[model samples]
Target: MRYVHLYFTCIKRSMISRLEYKKDTVVALFSFFFSNLCSLAAVYFILQAIPALAGYTLAEVGFFYGFSMLPISLDHLFSDEFWLVAYRRVKDGDMDMHFLRPVPVIFQIFAETFQPEGFGEMILGVALIAVCAGQLTVSLTVGALVVLCVGAVFGAVIITSLKVAIAALAFIFKRSGPLLQIIYNFSNYAKYPLAIYPFFIRTLLIFVLPFGLFISLPVDTLLTGAHDPWLLSLAIIGAAAVFFALALWIWTRCERRYESTGS
Candidate 1:
């Protein structure tokens, strides 16, 4: 409970600090929002011409695009600073400050450097979910809805785990920004039904990268029922566990080898 209070405190401080640069923050927010809106437009135009891509209808594809955004947006809102601060601070030798803090360095990084721009993606994500939920053919029960919501929470953690794991590579490489982005962009596959892609791409998305686990598979479980829930659920657990454990191990190794600017 004490740690929870500290976590909230970290977020509070970050928000207050961000509010000091209100204009810049708002601009960033709208810029990201507009960017995401353009993506939705692109999808709309594609479906307008073809009527259906693979077997999914317009509403089904839109639901996949929108519903999946919720968890990714949530991660961007909170845990994105892991990449922002980890890379920059390490390169600039500013990581020394974190060692002096009483809390864990990873926790400090995530909590301190908040990015409010993610609200752009987050707002549209929720709106998309609403628009598609009304049109979905599935008769999702209250219990099923709750299950999918839980899946969203897991999806956010999975995304963060991947980000932190990749970003942690910065501790050794000193410039993991591009590498991290390369892995992050793999989630672009989540925008459509996995069946539309080639077999290799689907395999990578499901097991190796597991971007398929983000929102699509969980939403599919909610809609179609989890005949093979383990296909996605276990893969998510396995992916997050592997990546997060690797990040922590690497972080520990790097911390032990750290040579501060003054030391």
Candidate 2:
């Protein structure tokens, strides 16, 4: 409870800092919104040209794309500071301030930024999902709805865990941003139906990076009834728990290796 209060307090401070430049905030929000809009438009154009992708219709593809944004946007909202840590802060010894704080360094990093730009993505994503869902003929089941909710919420946990684990490597290597970028790029592959990919790429997305596990699989379940929703939801929730625990372990171990650059 104390930690939860501290988290909100830190988030409030971060929000104040960001809102200090109201124009910049508005610009950033619009920028993210348009960026996502452009991507969605690209998908629409391609679907119009090709008509279908790997047996998935245009609406199915749109639903997949829209659902992909949920986990990514949530991660972007809460953990944007991890990008700075991975790319700059540790190398510049900027994390010294976080180390001096009473709270855990990881907690401080999590609380350091509250990105309002992600609201743009969230709004656009929800809107796209609603639009695409209306065009599809999906039978809504209790299990299916549960899986979608779990996938979106717990999927964010999985992505954030991956970010935290990768960012923590900066403590040892001084910068892990490139590797993190490479891994994160894999999430893009999840923005489409997994059936469109080759077997090996599909396996990698499911088992290795696991982006497709949470994003594509849940949507597939809804559209095609491909998997047992109860099992898939359990798998997503379980994977989130495991990934978060492993990420915390990795962060704890790597954090001990941090050395100030003395800049």
Instruction: Show the lowest summed lDDT stretch of 10 residues, model 1.
Output: 226-235
Highest-scoring model, TM-score: 2
For model 2, how does the per-residue alpha-carbon lDDT over 4-75 read when each residue is reduced to its tens digit? Answer: 999899999988888789998778777877777788888888888985898899888889988998889888
Clashes of each: 0, 0
| Best candidate (score: lDDT) | 2
lDDT of 1 by residue, 141-186 (tens): 6655654665567777777877877667777767677888888888
Q: So what's the TM-score on candidate 2?
A: 0.96
TM-score of each model, paired residue for residue: 0.88, 0.96
